[model samples]
Target: MTKILLETLKGNPSDRVPFWFMRQAGRYLPEYREIRQNAPSFMDFCYNPDQATEVTLQPIRRYGMDGAILFADILVVPDGLGQKVWFEAGHGPKLTPVNTEETYAELSLNGFHDKVGNVYETVSRLSKELPEEVTLIGFAGAPWTVATYVIEGAGSKDHAAVRQMGYGNPELFGKILDLLVDATSEYLCAQIDAGANVVQIFDSWSAAIPEPYFHKWIIEPTREIVARVRAKHNETPIIGFPRLSGAMLETYVLETKVDGVSLDTGVPLDWARDSVQRHVCVQGNMDPHLVVSGGDAMVNEATRILDTLKGGSHIFNLGHGFVPQTPPENVALLSETIKNFRR
Candidate 1:
C-alpha cells in the first residue's frame, strides 16, 4: 500500500486520513526553542545539519505526524543567491534588496549548494530516520514569495513596493524572477537528490495580485518551476501551497501541474471537493485558530471537511503553521479528533 500521504496524492483514498501541518516544525514547540539556543543564529541553526535535523524530527516524535517537513527557512534561497539574509529575534527575515542590475549582479549562483548544504543533510538524515509509514515532505518558497523578501528586504503589509517595481520596470523585475526560477529549481532538484520524498512549493503571497498580474507573476513562474522539477524527478509528488488563491486555485492546479494543491482556511470544502480535488489531491483547509480554540468549533470544522471530501483523495492538515502561542494540548486534541473521524 502507498504511504497514506503520498497515496492520497496519487488519487487513492487512505485507510484513515493522513495528517500533517504547515510549518509543522517551528517555534510552537518548546523543544524547538530549546534547541535553537544551541546554535549561534537562526541561519546557523538551519545550516547546522545536527541541529536542523533534530528540530525536523522533534514534531514527528511528539505528534507522530503522517509527514515530517524539513526544518529550514524559505529565505535560504536568498542567502544562496548572494544576498545577505538574517533574522532579528522579534523581526523576521531581512535581506539585501536587489532593485537594479548592479545590485542583482552581486548575486552569484556559484557554490549555491555549498551555501545551503545543511538543508540537504537534514533531508538525508530524515529519510533514513523517519518511520516508513510517515512520508518526508521537502519544500521551498516559490519565486514570487521569496522574491518579495529579496526585493523588499523583509516582510511587507501590502507588498506595494515590490509590485510597484514589477509594474514600473518589467525588464529588471523579469530578470530577478528568472534568476529565482533557475536557482529555486536547482535547489529543489538537489533536495530531491538528497532524499526528499515529496517537495512542496509555498507561494504564500499569490493572492495579493489581481488576475492579470497573478498570471504573470504567480501562475506562470510556478508553472515553469513545476515543469522543470518534473523533468528530473517524476516519482516525487510536488504539492503547491498558494496560500490565498481562492477563486483561482483550480486554474493554478491545472496550469502548474502540481500533484496536489493545499487549501487555505478560506476555501470552502464543498467547492474544493467538487472543483480542486477532481484535478489533484487536496491537502489542508483546517483553521489553525480553531485548533487553538480546541472545542466544538475545532471538532465540527474538522468533521465537516472530512465528510465533504470523504470519497476523494485528501490529507488532513492545518490551513497554516501552528502558531507559537497555541497550547500543545490543543494540537493533541485536534490531532485525535481528526484520527477519530470516518466516513
Candidate 2:
C-alpha cells in the first residue's frame, strides 16, 4: 500500500492531505505518561526499544495519524558523542557544557552507533510493527540547534553565549558543526537502514540565529547533512523544519535541497503557498494552542489552514509540538477535521 505521508513527501499528488504532529507521541496522552512512569529516567525510557515502540504507537492507536515519528530525543546525538546528558525532574534536558575548543575536541564519534543502538533497534521494530500505511519518521536535532545545547549546556532565552561564539569564534564553531555533520549523517543513515521511510532535521533554535549568520550556521550545516544522507539513501525523503525562519525559508529550501519543508506558525499561509509549497511539499503552520482550546475555535483555525494550503502538496500538522495540557479530545477533533476536509 502506498503511504500517503511518503507520497506527499515525494511531492506526489494524494487523494487528501496527510497529518501528524511534531511531538505526537508524548506527554499529552495518559497512556504515554503511564509508560513513562515505568522507566526510571527519560534517557532510560528512550533506550528501551519495547517501551519506546509502545509509546511510538500509542498516538497512532488513538488518533490513526498518517505518520508515526520515532519516540526519541535530539540530545541523543550529544550523548552519543560522549557528553554528559541528563534530565532533571521539573527542568528539561541538562548537559555538561562544552564551551571551549578543548571540550569540543573531547566529542568523538567512535562509539556513536553503540550508544544509540537502541534507537536504531526501536526503528527496526517500529518498521515491522507500524501499519503498512503509516509512514515511520526518524529525526535528529540540526547541528546548530544541537550545538547550542552542547555549548550553552541547556536551553537559553537569547542564545547569547552561543551566538557570541559563532561570531567571535567562527573557526571553532565551524569545527563543532563539522563534527555534528559527520555524526548526524551516520546517525540518520542508521535510521534509514533500520527502515525509516522519511527523516526530518529539526532546527528548533533557527529563530534565535542572527540573520547574517543564517546561511553559515543554519543553511550550510544542514546542506552538508542532507547531501551526505542523500548520497547513501537517494530514495528516502528528507524534511527540513527550520522553525521561525521567516523570509529565509525560500533560501533554506533552495540551498539545502530538502524534499519537504515544515513551516512554523509564524509563516504566513499565502507566503508559504506561493514561496514554499510551489517548490516542495509543505507540512504545518497551525497554532498548537488551538488544539488546547478545542471546539469551534480549533475547527475554524484548522479549516483555514486546510483551505489556505489546499492548492498544493501539504501535510496537516501543528506549528510545533502538542503541549502537555492539550486535551486528548481536541486531538481527536483535529484529526476528524483533517480527515473530513476537502479541497
Candidate 3:
C-alpha cells in the first residue's frame, strides 16, 4: 500500500493531506484507560511490549490515522540509562538529580539496549501489524529536552536549574549533553532496525531556552543525532519538533537538516508557508485546546489550517499532544474534517 504520510514527510503534500496527532492514543480514549488498569505503573506500561503495542495501535484502529506514533515516554531514555526514574501520581515524573559530571557518568550504555529492548520489540510488532498504508513513527526526547529532566530531576516551570547548571559548570553540563547524543543515536538506530518507518525527535522544552544559547543547546546536539541516525539508516526520514522556537525555527530547519519540522501553536500560518515550507515538510501549528472544544469550533480551525497549508507540503496535526480532559468525539470530528479536505 502507498503511504501518504511517508510521502508528506519526504516533502510531498498530496491532495489527500495525510495526518496523525501527537499523543494520539493516550488518556482521552476510554479503551486506553481499560488497558492502563492492567499495568502497575506508567513506566511499567511503557516497558511491556504487549501493552505498549496495544496502546500505540488503539488510535489507528479507532480513527484510521495515517501515522501511528510509538506508545512510550521521553523519560524512558534516562530510566534505561540507570538513572533513578519514576512517575509520581498527580505530580508527574521524578528522578535522581544529575548535577555534577560524577553523577552523570554513572549513566552507562553497558546494558542500556537490554533495559530498553521492550521499546524495540514494540516497534517490531507494530511494523508487522499496522495497516500497510499507515506509517510507523518511532521517537525519543531530544538530548537537550531529556537533559533538562536529568538536571532538574523532573519537569520544571522554567528549567531554571538546568540553565543555572549550564552557566555555573559548563564542563559538567557539556558532558551530560555529549553522553545523551551518543546514547540517543543508538536508541533511534535500534528502533529503525526494529522496523520503524520514520522517527521524530521531540525537543519539547526547546521553547524554554533563551535565544543566545539556543544554538549551543538545541541545534548542536540535534544536528549530531540527525547525522548519526542517517549514517545507519540513510533513507529514513526524521522530523524535528522544536516547540515555540519562534523566528529561530527557520534557522533550526536549515541547520539540523531534518526532513520535516513540527510547528508549535505559536507559529504563524502564512509565515511558515512562505518561509519554512519552501525548504522542508511542515507538520503542524493547531492548538490542542480547540479539539477539546469540539463541534464547529474545532472544525473551523482544522479547516483553516488545511486550506492555508494546502498550497505546500503539509501534514495535519496539533501544535502539541492531547490533554487528558479532551473529549474523544472531538478527535473523531477532527478526523472527519481531514478526510473531507481537498486542495
lDDT (CA) for every model shown?
A: 0.87, 0.93, 0.92
User: What does candidate 3's lDDT look like per residue over 1-343, in tens digits?
Assistant: 8899998887666789999999998999999999999899999999999999999999998899999999999888888889999989989999999997679878988899999999999999999999999999999999999999999998998999899888888899998999899889999999999999999999998885777689999999999999999998999999999998898999999999999999999999999999999989999878999999888888899999999989888989999999999998888889989999999
Range of the 10 consecutive residues with the lowest summed lDDT in candidate 1:
1-10
For residue 323, what is the lDDT in candidate 2?
90
Clashes of 2: 0
Model 3, residue 144: C-alpha shift (Å): 0.9
Provide the lowest-lDDT 10-residue window in model 3: 7-16
Question: Model 1: per-residue lDDT, tens digit, 241-325?
Answer: 9999879899989989999989998998888999989888999889888877888888888888888888788899888888887
Give the TM-score comparing model 2 with the true structure, all chains together: 0.98
Estimated TM-score for each candidate? 0.97, 0.98, 0.98
Q: After TM-score superposition, what is the CA distance of residue 28 in candidate 2 from its true location, in Å?
A: 1.0
lDDT rank, highest first? 2, 3, 1
Best by lDDT: 2
